[model samples]
Target: MAAPAATAAPSVPPSLSLPPSQFARIQPHAYLLAHLSPPSASNQPSIRANGRAPSQFRVTSANAGSLTHTNGSAVVRIGDTAAVCGVRAELLHTEDIASWSVSQASSSNKRRRLADLGEKPTEEDEDEDPEDDRAHIEDLNLLVPNISLSTGCAPGFIPGAAPSALAQSLSHQILSLLHSTRLVRADDLRVWYQQPNLGPEEPERHNENEQMDVDAEQSATIEDKPREIKAFWVLHIDIMIISLAGNPFDAAWAAVLAALRDTKLPKAWWDVDNETIVCSDSVSDARKLSLRGLPVASSFGVFEADAAAGWRANVIPDATEQTQTGKKGSPERWILADPDGYEEGLIQERACIVVDKQKDGKTTIVKMEKNGGWTVDTEDLRQLVEISAQRWDEMKRILDQC
Candidate 1:
């Protein structure tokens, strides 16, 4: 008789059953890209979701001054992404800031300086101390920005915990961008306070506290009037991401622009007697903040021919020929501007381009960020900028309408 048939091995059931397609099972993002990618014509994506052109952005909507408490506020929506920005202005006494710097320098920084070199500061160093006075403490930190990304905005964010690294980095980036661009007028924030002359006996008053950035020759000819910035307007800008589909930077930038444009600061007067600044409560006394330029941000998702087509296509195009060692070559990428969440996940290259149209009609690039490992040529960047300019115009038109 035949040897007892080998006992059949038991089969273990699969823990999960994935989609039938190989890419769908192994890489869901690739499957999504392959199935949902826009139709191609001439090796380019021809159309996007919802019948949009490849370069077209999703519908944008903005509403200004949405919050009552804030000096200015706005809600901006870019497709499924939503962000709310609020601006609040406060008066900061220049003297107080100088004093704090001086105190801190004297107490802590001075100790560090002494400890580092094992010697006291030299006379020249003392004379050149940056914390000595208001002029030396040129703190251009008038605008403070914070970004909030709670669990409600996205699934990964934990509730009740401090903002994630992503949020903090975004916040710092926004602040740096605002400062580098000089979007707000510096002169507008300056306001002076001076005591009245007693019985018109005070000589031409000249003091360091009453100094201005006037030229030496210009100061000699000017009349006796306080031009010093005793107090300044510090704008506290808060941006909250309520919903995120993709492209947080673009949505946040739009919201910030709208809110800042709508900003109105209450008339503040420095009280010589009280040594404080008094802000007017009347809405009629509120003045609109000066805006230098409006910068619009455009985000793009880069999709390579290999990834975009995935397993669905018969042949995948590579940017460069493969080497004899069988190593993969560079990939040819197509940019999808204002990509939704699904498209963003599959993309390896992302770019955020900011453009501002000056009053004289010249368009300037405020900032451009290209992230991820994919390589983009100058021609592609030029094309991207052209699209960004067009999108900026579109965003401006929408803002103007609202």
Candidate 2:
């Protein structure tokens, strides 16, 4: 079957309407200049005024507490591109009372039986009350690009349809990166309960090591002690891509850091063994999430476009400049660092670098993804590492302020 004829552009009020040409003309400065500049000045003054090379970064700014409704909220802006993230916290509760009531009854009965046997209920019970906190965390969803393309960057987007598939992929990359690095700890939100009164007949203390002889007639069974304290904090990160001026990864990272800065975990009472959760309102009752060091990711583009030859290879940085220089004129493509979107349009190879910093003033590249287009010599890789180490402390300072 033949494809349906394209429909005419929808007519709307002049003030609210924009032409396709107008939208297309609003491309990134890097893109526009790359094509418009004279060959003599093609690469001159192309980077931002902040002293960043075309491949370098601008002065990234991040701020927290932009929203009152959320537990935490932050805005991260890199040049003109901006991303806002808000964290909303809600306690987990049973949908029906029957299930909860039954569980409570079973626990109470077990305690009663232990009391009757002249055994004291252990302090272990104090911890079980917060088990539900972890469940609350797992149920949370981090909505990225939540506002979608309605902001006008993506014209003619279908209603109810998500931002394009590419947007989803990028968002997932940001979300998964945050999760795997343990940037947000789930156990810091626990709130303890009021002390329960013990009956007069109960023993003052019971030796935990001493086991009671099992009797068929007895009504109490001791549960195995929990090995790990359950996580009590539930961080619900909502990332809204306010504007996509390119460089979504950096924008996402800055947003996540900012969101965490103002984040306050709600106090919760928990039981690990029983997996129960109770929300607490007092600030004194809550604990802060421990922040591991910031693990930042950088991507470089390796573009090799020979329009005359009718050949174009768009690739990310798979090797450093030193390596490519060593094999000067080698058709084998390789890039040291990931460039912005415009650079990607002309790249033939690429690489991804993830740097991890230690508390002892040491730094190392924990992860590297390299492609075969080019190779990075050890010396140039060392230079990149040195640059990262020098910049990491500054980055952490910026993150801490958020």
Among these predictions, the greatest TM-score belongs to 1
Predicted candidate 1 versus true structure: per-residue lDDT over 1-402, tens digit per residue: 778889889998886855545645578654555544645654654554345666879989999979999989999999999999999988777777846456545545665777688976654554345443333223647788899985788777778888788788889878777866667765556565544534322345587443442344344445333234577788889999999888888888889999988999877877777877888889999888777778888888877656544432224344222311226645445578898876777777688888988778787998988877435657778988899888878888988876
User: What are the per-model C-alpha RMSD values against the true structure?
Assistant: 12.3, 13.7
TM-score between candidate 1 and the true structure: 0.71
lDDT of 2 by residue, 305-338 (tens): 2321112223324334434465545333223243
Which stretches in model 2 have alpha-carbon errors above 4 Å?
1-51, 93-150, 153-161, 189-233, 270-277, 305-328, 331-341, 370-382
Q: Each model's C-alpha lDDT?
A: 0.73, 0.55
lDDT of 1 at 290: 72
TM-score of each: 0.71, 0.60
TM-score of model 2 relative to the true fold? 0.60
